[model samples]
Target: MQKLNLSQSLSQKLSPQQIQFIKLLQVPTAELDTRIEEELEINPALEEGKEEETEQSQDDDFEDSYDDDLGRDDHELNLDDYLDDEYSGYKMQGDGNYNSDDDDREIPISSQTSLHEQLITQLNFLKLDDRQKIIGQQLIGSIENDGYIRRDLEAIINDLAFSQNIETDIDELEEILRKIQTFDPAGIAARTLQECLIIQLERKEHPDDPVVKHALLIVQDCFEEFTKKHYSKIQKRLDLDEEGIKDAVNLITRLNPKPGGASDGLVRTQYIIPDFILTNNGGKLEVSLNSKNAPELRISRSYADMFDAYDKSDKKDKKLKDTVTFVKQKLDAAKWFIDAIKQRQNTLLRTMEAILNYQKEFFIDGDETNLRPMILKDIAERIDMDISTVSRVANSKSIQTEFGVYPLKYFFSEGIATDSGEDVSNREVKSVLQGMVDAEDKKRPLSDDKLVKMLNKLGYNIARRTVAKYREQLQIPVARLRKEL
Candidate 1:
């Protein structure tokens, strides 16, 4: 038997307050409004109203009415006093502080019809009977967002029989699935890549065009070889020149590999909200957190009133005990939430301010050459926070500079030492690589080794493998693939 030792270590754990802070830190400005709305919906004690009316009503209702009643009356004092506010105001800033009025884009909340919905809509136009339509609807629902139906025919057959109470043969279901694949988005509802390509080929406007017809034949008979870029075999079989092969390859590339992706209805748009805004003001770099992301948040005045009333109320009433507990819990939560929001705003500002200050030269010049190699640890050390915390802040957050909106992570790069003992950012190296590729002769593409040599001559001692890796990262293919007739 193995002896096991169990020991409880006393380590400082994050309080709920701290957890709430981290959560708030992660929310970007673009989604802050929605998050605020969500909070207002969940916490009834937290109300949203105009600044003036909110203050006056809370003071008159809670302080003047409830506070007096609670202090004077000995009658098993009503706990309602604990729920009234003295004065509360939620100041929604118009220009800065989590709400930039300049950004006119408004995200509509109405749910758009999804890809499945659109498919079902098309299915409705088909001349199928009620039963067939039901089967088609079931099939459409089974197709995933990518528009592929990975489930086997037997599984779909059983689903049709048991779930929908409609018996259907495997062959019948496959036929219906094929019909669905033939819908407007050429390759949608396909069971396999082969099927998708075939469906697209069938829908081609000029199906008899020699290049397309040859490409279709290649897909049908030699998909494996074609995928491996065995262009010689394809050319020999079709008796086509290098130019003809290039055109055939171009035609194949034009076909949608995933037909379902063409329908915007099938995809969810991700909106990026920047946490910081950087602008150049008279040769100085100015940085500010997008205040719109950090709404004017505070403890709901009503909760504070409730706390006051609870403090004044007689402590023995059973009803008042639960209400008091409830008030304390909510007040604690509200306070934590507000504190978290404030901390998040402060942290973001501090981090971004450090970045702007550190990269002031780069921002002012708008040149990659001026970028100093910096990382999350550098910012974390500057701000006196853990590296992980800085990373979390930088991960999804974006900054809107006069140049363009970029992810905060984009500014950070590792340094490489130069011969003169100067550090250079890898970003600068990538920029150089991109420039070289852009200026390289297409007819005689530069190989990774040649590119490495070119960089070495330019005083950057980078290895060939590193050059290849960076080139691949930039989405540039190998020299052979880059070669053009």
Candidate 2:
């Protein structure tokens, strides 16, 4: 059956310009330059640098003359077709303008050879045949960032036989694996945590030292007890006294748990470029965007001149019409990009201003306790924007404060009610919880139940389970795990 139906409904959709604005708004200061560069490469009409003031009046007159000349023909391109309230020329936000001082400053970036490359370089030092080198390379590939190869040798054998066309037995693979485990890191490619620790201990310059010998024995024998903090069990199983066990445990803790992390200096350090900079001048806190966010962008003057030249020429030629259409599209894209960048700057300032005003106390003193319990809705309402818009700014953006650089998300936390009938930030409670753990007797660490009671005594209405959750969030272990010899 064929049928046609119509019903009244309402729906909303984002225009191309709106979509572009949303994407640009979410980009952080660190990535904004790259995004602008991509746009400049793709759209020939969009260019970098400030728009010249003298050219503005000439461009306006050219547009006016072209509009009047082209408006008469139905087939001719109309300049007004691309002109709208949403379309805007190059406009600058004064706060984000590039400062000559900032341009002159040099930001140091740390670089290093990656972990895999270093491992391969070390692999090259081993004397082996071409086939053996290939097998060794395959083994090196299996090492993870943490410097552990959890894959079974049998599985690797199967992989090599199928993919590399090398039929090697587990013995040959184990021979290569043992050599890799002895790499520079001292624990490079161990199969397990125990193996990693023992490998490091065995490689110690003073392996004959009593502490190193006992540490190796404990790691090789009573690893489970050592991990569970069952010091009594480890003492009984290893026949070690308290001081012997303490020294061995201390040595074990000194070993790099993640061997790959020991080579962090050999990895490129990630720098956090803040989107906002907040400074407390005397008693007032001022917030401003990183100068990078406010990029100087404008429509290409050559493109604009080309459009004017084409529009002023004869309109009867089909080739000219096609060229005009293409030029108009590019101009439209350039205008849209400039307009979107302007909107993004406005939105970022608005959202960040709301957040700065809301947490003014925290910024003044750099105290987490001073931070108000804030959510995306609070800032969104204050800025008269949507919650999602606020979230987009907070999630990926960071602010450089007097204390340190912190992600915008760090200031946002859930509220907790106190006995005084006032709301406080959950971060405050976590701070208190961390303080208690730091000052607790390690031999008999405070349990969650004790933590809850202590918090309640201090006028915080918290439960044991809530205390446990906060503890986990702070990366603090249970009372048992926190125990010491």
Candidate 3:
């Protein structure tokens, strides 16, 4: 049996233009140029460079032409025959203007070899059997960027068997690893910090020297004590005086902890392109978007003239009609994109203006302690936008100030309550905590409990766990690790 059913349902959907704008809003300044280039390649009617007419004239012409054409109903002209993304009837094509300076603007390529490549080059000097050579290469590949092989030997053996069809045990791998550790870098493939130090210490020019021997002993036997700065305990066990231990500690400290990092000098540096530029003109902060963000884009003048010609003709010819359909689609897309760009520019400025106004004190004085406790909701209310919009801006955007270039989100922090009934940014508390740690005696570092008590006396009543969390965020080690010889 068949039954006919009728129901009405209502749902909201975003148009293609809206989806594109949302994506564009999230593109950081580094990538916005790429996105614009892609759009220019695809959309023929959308071209770069402003129209020769004045801004007022361009707006008047856009309002007159695009609005009239885009707003047409079927009663005036039929759109039954048109091209779309899936439609293969007609193809729209436009020649792109490639900027010659773009090539010059790119960062120059480096000719220096990377660390792993150098390791492989050294492997050529080893005289091993075919199987042994393969295992050696695999071991070198397993080494991390920091030149340490943290992976388990057994796991690597299994991987070699499964992936490379090489059957080897841990002893064979360990033997080969010892050879790799002796490579030119002094401590290339050590498994741990102690091993890395010992490898370097053994390679020292005067290993028999008293200071060198003591340094080796400290790294090999008293590594736990060395890391915890328990020099007195190490001295008692090794029967070394304070002067000898101090010299040994100084020698060990002079050795490079990260051998692989030495090769990074040849690597190219990364530069951050800020999305917003904030200048303090005599304490009056002026906010502006990056110049790259405000590219001069306009409707292609030739395409506009073609549309005018098409409108003048009462052509019943199919060829003329086909051209009209293609032009209409491109024009519509161009106008939508232009409008979206304008909206995105306005939205970015509005959101950034709200943030600048809210954090004016911090910007003017260049003091992080003055930063207020702010969240997305606070900016959203001021700018009359959604919290999500503010989040999108804050997540990827950065501002260059007199003090430094900072990510926009760095200004927004969680609040902590003080005993005086005032709210302060958690960043302020972290700053204070860091200051105390910096001033503490290295041999007597303050524990988290002590830090909490000190902070309480300073009027910030936070828990011990919170103190530990903040210390970890600041990259400060535990009290034991902070001790010195």
Model 2 CA lDDT for position 228: 93
lDDT for each residue of candidate 1 in 256-277, tens digit (9 for 90 to 100): 8876673454466777777778
For model 1, the stretches where C-alpha displacement exceeds 4 angstroms are 1-8, 47-111, 129-138, 151-170, 241-244, 262-271
Q: Which stretches of candidate 3 lie over 4 Å from their true place?
A: 1-12, 42-45, 52-107, 110-113, 128-130, 254-266, 302-337
- Order of all candidates by TM-score, from best down to worst? 2, 3, 1
TM-score for candidate 3, residues paired by index: 0.81
Q: Superposing all C-alpha atoms, what RMSD in Å does each candidate have to the true structure?
A: 6.7, 6.8, 6.0
- For candidate 3, the C-alpha RMSD (Å) to the true structure equals 6.0
What is the C-alpha local distance difference test score of candidate 3? 0.81
Model 1 pairs whose backbones collide:
82-306, 97-291, 97-292, 98-291, 98-292, 98-293, 98-294, 99-291, 99-292
All models: lDDT? 0.74, 0.81, 0.81
Estimate the TM-score of every prediction. Answer: 0.80, 0.86, 0.81
Over 388-409, each residue of candidate 2 has an lDDT whose tens digit, in order, gives 9999989999999879999999
By TM-score, is 1 or 2 better? 2
Q: Which ten residues in a row have the lowest lDDT in candidate 1?
A: 66-75
Candidate 2 residues lying further than 4 Å off, grouped into runs, are 1-10, 54-111, 262-266, 316-319
Worst 10 residues of 2 by lDDT: 65-74
